[model samples]
Every structure is written in C-alpha cells, then in structure tokens.
Target: MTVSVRALRPGNRSDAEAFARIRMLALPYVFFTADSVEHLTARLHPDAHFTALLAEDDGEAIGTAQLSLAHESPEPGQALLNVHVRPDRTGRGAGTALVQAGEELLAGLGAHKVFSWVLDEPADRVFAERRGYRPGSTAQFLLLDLAKAELPPVPAPPPGVELRTAADFADDPRPLFELDAECTADEPGDVDHRLGDYGAWLEETWRHPLLRHDLTTVAVADGRPVAFTAVRTDGGVRYGTGMTGTARAHRGRGLAKLVKADSLHRARAAGFTEAHTGNDAGNEPMLAVNRWLGYRVCAREVQHVRELG
Candidate 1:
C-alpha cells in the first residue's frame, strides 16, 4: 500500500472523525472531538496559518499532523508540528510521510524553529532524534480515578471570596477572559504566549466543544474572578483539566488548589468517571495540588525542538 500526505478537508466528516480518532488514541490524556477539529480548521487566526494534514495509506487515514505558527507569541518564526500515527499502523511509513509534509509546510511558512511533543518512550524518542530533533523539557500526564479515588473536601474560600463556576460568566465572559490571559502569561512552556486578542480566545477556547463551562470552578473575590480551573470533558466518561491558575495578586492564598478541588468535585458529580491533566516537571505547586487531589503520574511526554537552518 502507498502512503500519501494531504491537507485535511474540513467539509468531509469522515476525515475529521478519523483525525480526532487518531489523536485520541495516540494522546488520550488530552481531550479531542470531531467538532473541535472542525472548529479549529474553520476558526484559527489568519496569521496562524494553521494546517491540519492527514496521511492515508491507499484510502484509509493512518496518521494526522497539526501544523501552525505560534501567532500569539511575541517571538516570530516559532512553529509547532504534532504528528501521531495510529498505533496499529506505526510500522508503516505514515508517520515519516506526515512529518516530512508537515515540516516542509512550516518551513515554507518561514518558521525558523519547530517544536513537537513525543511520548516519553524509547521508540518515540528515537524517532524524533532520528529526525534531528533534540529533547527539551518533559511533562507528566496525571490521572485520577474519579469513581474510586477519594478527593479532598472542597475547601471554603477565604474571607470575602466565594467559589463560582464558569457558568456564572454566561452573560459576559470578558472578565474570565482577562483572568485567563493573566494566568496563561505565566504558564510554563518554551514559547511565551500573550492572549491579548479576545476574539481569538472566544473562537478558539470559549466555543471549544470540550470546554465544560458548568464543570469549571472559579474563585470570585470582590466581584471578580481571581482564580479558576478550566474543565474539558470528552462527551464520555473522561474529564480533563485544561488549566488551573490564580491571578497574580491572588497567588499564595491557595486559591488555585481551592478552585481545582471544586472543579474536580463538580466533574465527578457530572458523571465523569476518570480525569486527566498534565504539568511541566518544574511546576511544583500545581503538582502538589494534583497529588492532593489523588492524581498520579500515568505517562510522560518530552518536548522536542528542532532548529531549521
């Protein structure tokens, strides 16, 4: 059978479904859905030049690649290409073909450096290294058995503070958007991102299919959201924490922990049986919070970076 890589057709439901399926199978820790895939293809910023590619052997989609520039980052020429091949079809040439196609597209788009996440496994590491990518930082995917694990009791907010849900911002989410921007700026990663564009955030995040606004818990103080734990549920039994953070002034008050615990409880109450989240190895405070919530390291993925000359 021959493998070929081509751009994804947004109008085709099967193509979108296949792409989401491979992503879920290869990276189950993260949340994905066909609708989310379609939203991404249709709504990404024009400057991002986002391109989703699929690798097909004969007529079956065996691998998928997501390529795009880090448009929100101040530093230009930074791009990302994440390729995942179906587990059962790994021995074939799908991955190689997809990666090559993805890299070529990004390079042509003037991306000077490319970053990718590879599962922290022998074969995966070797594959990236063989392609001239060097290992960088690592992240851990933690899982909690919501049905069987005992979660810490939801802690009451400090004086003048109250626990709220993302749903509370239904009438106007701009404040939550501001809080998200502040917290995202401090998130650990190689690229420094600025979420200054409200329209982009609305299209990319607020409207995301997996975003469980009702399950997301926020800490409100003085009529403003000071801390929050964003929730993403796979329309199934699985739930994931998209992010948990406290605003700059609210740090050191344990608000992050408080919000995350509240969100987890809501997720369990909403019928989610399992939960997953990821953290950079160096983020100790959040790691501690996850441990307190009974999340254990289920897998690890290493960030790999390649500088194109």
Candidate 2:
C-alpha cells in the first residue's frame, strides 16, 4: 500500500471525523473531537501557518499531523510538527510520509528549529532519533478516574476571595486573558509562549470548540479574577484542563488548588468520569496539587528538537 499526505479538507465531516478517530486511537490522553479538529484547522492564528494534514494509505486515512510555526515564541523560526499513526497502521510508510510532507511545509516557512513531542516509548523515541531529533525536556500526562478517585474537598476561599466559573465572565474574558498571560510567562517550557495577541487568543483559545466554560473554575479576589483552571471537555464523560494558574501576588493562598478542586468537584457532580492533565517534570507545585487530587501518572512525552541549518 502506498501512503500519501495532504492537507485535510475543510468542512468535510468524514475527513474531520477520520482525523479525530486517528488521534484518539493513537493518543487517548489528549482531547479531540471532529468539530474541535475542524475548528482548530480553521481558527488557528494565520501567522502560525498551522495546517492539519492527513496521511492516507490506499485511499484510507491512517495518520494525522499538525505542522505549524511556533508563532508565539519569542525566538525566531521555531516550528512544531507532531505526527500520529494508528497503532495498527505503523511499520508502513504513513508516518514517514507525514514527516516528509510536514517538514517541507515548515522548511518553506523558514523554520529554523523544529520541535516535536514524541511519546516516551522505545519505538517512538527511536523513530525520532533516526530522523535527527534529540531528546529535550519531559512532561507527564496524568489521569484521575473521577468515579473512583477521592478528590480533595474544594477549599473555602479566604477573606476577599470567592469562587466562580469561566462562563460568568463570558461577556468579557479580559480578566481571564490577563491571568492566562501571566501564568504562561511563568510556565516552565522550551518555547516562550507569551499570549500577547489578544485577538489571536480570542480566536484560538477563547472561541475553541471544546472549551467548557461551565466547568472551568475561577478564583476571584475583591471581584477580580486572580487564579483559574480552564477546562476542555470531550462533550462526554471525559474532561481535561486546558490551563490552570495563579497570579504571583496571590500565590500563597492555595488559589491554584482551590480553583482546580472546585472545577473537579463541579465536573464530577456534572457526571464527568475521567480527568486528564499534563505537567512539566520540573513543575513541583502543580504536581503536588495533582497528587493531592489522586491523579496518577499515566504517560510521559519527551520533546525532540532538531536545528535546521
């Protein structure tokens, strides 16, 4: 069977669902839906040059790839390409074809440093290594079986504090935007992802299809949002935190834990059964919160970096 990669057709329900299925089969931890995939392909920042690619073998969609410039990075010419093939479709040419096609797109965009997050598995690491990528930092994916796990009780807010949901600020998400920017700047990562473009953030994050504002918890101090945990849903029994953080000025009050616990309790009460989140290996404070919430490490991914001459 011959494998070929091409841009995913926009507004095609079959293609979108196929792409979503492939992603779910390959990496169940991440959240994705046909609508979310289509939304991302359509709404990602134009400056990023983001594209969703599908690899087909003999006319059947077998793999998926997302290639784009890291437009938010302060550094020049950083690109990202993550490829995933169905577990039953590996050892064929699908993965290779996707990589070749993705690199061509990035190279044409003048990308100088290409980074990929490869699962911390032997075959996956070897495939990246053979393609010139070197291991970078590690991050862990965690899972909490909400039905079985004993979550920490949501803590009462201290003086001048109160709990709210992201939906409460739907009319104006500026406060959440500011809180996100501050936390992102402090997040430990290779790329300096500063959410400086409010318009881009609105199109990409605020209007994303899966963002569950109703389940997202916010910590407000004196009527101002100071900490929050934004959640994304599978539109079913699973939920994942998109972003969670606390403003530096209000760090010691356990606002991070407070908002997350509140969010989890709400999610559980609302019938969500599974919760997923990721943390950089070095981020201890957030890790402690996850542990306290009974989340266990389910998988890990190692970033692979390759500098283009």
* Candidate 1 off by > 4 Å: none
Q: Residue 180 in candidate 2 has what lDDT?
A: 96
Clashing pairs in 2: none
lDDT of each: 0.91, 0.92
User: Across residues 97-183, which tens digit of lDDT does each residue of candidate 2 receive?
Assistant: 898898988999999899999999999999999999999999999999998888878888888999989899999999899999999
Score candidate 2 by TM-score against the native.
0.98
Error of 1 at 82 (Å): 0.3
Candidate 1: residue 263 lDDT (0-100): 83
Candidate 1 least-lDDT 10 residues: 7-16
Candidate 2: worst-modelled 10 consecutive residues by lDDT: 148-157
